[model samples]
Target: MFGLILDVTARIHYALRGLMPTNVLLDALHTRRGLKWGVPAMLLAVPYALAAVFCTSQVEAGGSGWFNLLALIFAWNALKFLVAGPLTLMRLLWVLGREANARRRAARALLGEGFGPELVEEPVLTSRRA
Candidate 1:
């Protein structure tokens, strides 16, 4: 029974994930190339924030109570984008550092076994009269 419940929950989770529009954007932002653009993407939050403010004003002006829901949604989206930017930047730096270390380790391995820089001989030049 527990296994069946877990399976159903996982299926529902994935179904909901597919329905969310932001899932695609979030997935792209997590990638290596996408990480580099995260700082720029933060600008997207500005529009969301503006929309939220507009909705809030509409609600306060007695436009409609439903405007409050829109305001909350916009606010949440704005916060998500604002926070995603810095998090992605930090992740990008960590990935770059890891890659650099891996490359250094590979190079050291290639230069191992009597192939140290000190063991390399400089080319000797000889002058000859033609």
Candidate 2:
């Protein structure tokens, strides 16, 4: 169970890491290090419990024990998504935040003080549909 959990965790963590904006998730979770991973893991509980039912049903239907075990493992995979996915994404953002800060600091150092206001925020480009 532990190995299965870890394997699924590593796979899904890396997979979904790039799906959303890092800064946004960081703002939502309010942590540079990691936070979003916490509650979202609870979502896995549903799929896991469902998989458990599937596994038991397979058993009752005379499926191989190995198949039941596989189902249980897959269910745990769902749980792992709940655990590691959000956290991994958040941690990835923190890593990105660290790099971004480093670059900004370097730029400011080169610019040598009095570089007023955040430079070049998202530009508002308004265009009407043709």
Candidate 3:
């Protein structure tokens, strides 16, 4: 039972690590970097949400099918800003708050103590222009 729980937890942690933005996650974990990138992203989202609301009002007045499609796009953008974006950030914080395998791996890498399989470098691309 204990082993099963550990396995599940490790998998969950691994998934969370993959979801995380590497630099941001490492900065947040190692130092106490707060809202450096997150604040800018949220600030940008605000105007988009407001624009969506304005478009919604305009679309209602028009009562045209084509405009409805535009309204749908506006609504999607608004929902991403007002709902999904914040929820994602909240989830990230929640995941980061706990002790996980990701944190261990990060710490190990930072301390130059890695002991897994070596990473392979990406191949260089050469462009030929005629």
Candidate 4:
């Protein structure tokens, strides 16, 4: 788990960390604005979903408010993920330290039994622009 996490960090840092001083990228993921946008987005989604379901009409002549509401909510939810979700997940990664850690832990648990972890290194490329 640690190795995978470290490897990801190594890759990001060694690659083009375009954000200013670069070290700033290592800081927490939960930017104030990111949380601000993310929370309301998630909160609004629930009621919108329920409202959509309730407003719709049944099979036959389904042109009811419920159907429209459902469509609206679905669209809203899709938009939310398109914008808000990544921010929240990025915040999660920020708080948790690294995404690779979460994936590694989940992978280990799924594998069960006694299968040890292994290190797989990738070669770094160099350009001779000189």
Q: Give each model's clash number.
A: 0, 2, 0, 4
Error of 3 at 81 (Å): 2.2
Per-model CA lDDT versus the true structure: 0.82, 0.62, 0.54, 0.52
Question: What is the C-alpha local distance difference test score of candidate 4?
Answer: 0.52
Where model 4 places Cα greater than 4 Å from the true spot, the runs are 1-32, 36-40, 58-70, 73-75, 78-86, 91-130
lDDT of 4 by residue, 1-130 (tens): 9999999999887675556331232222246544535545555556655654555534225555556756665656545544555677677658566657766665565445333344212222333363
What tens digits encode model 2's per-residue C-alpha lDDT throughout 1-130? Answer: 9999999999998777656444244345545444545465456567667878888888889988887776766676666555556666667677889988977776665445434345323222333353
Q: Which segments of candidate 3 are over 4 A away from where they belong?
A: 1-40, 60-64, 99-130
TM-scores for all candidates: the values are 0.78, 0.42, 0.36, 0.30
For all the candidates, what are their Cα RMSDs to the real structure? 8.3, 12.0, 16.2, 19.1
Give Cα distance to truth, residue 108, candidate 2, Å: 1.9
lDDT of 3 by residue, 18-80 (tens): 665532443453333443344345454566566666667777787556666666666665454
List ranges where model 1 is wrong by over 4 Å. Answer: 1-10, 113-130
TM-score of candidate 2 on Cα atoms, chains taken together: 0.42
On TM-score, the candidate that comes out on top is: 1
lDDT of 1: 0.82
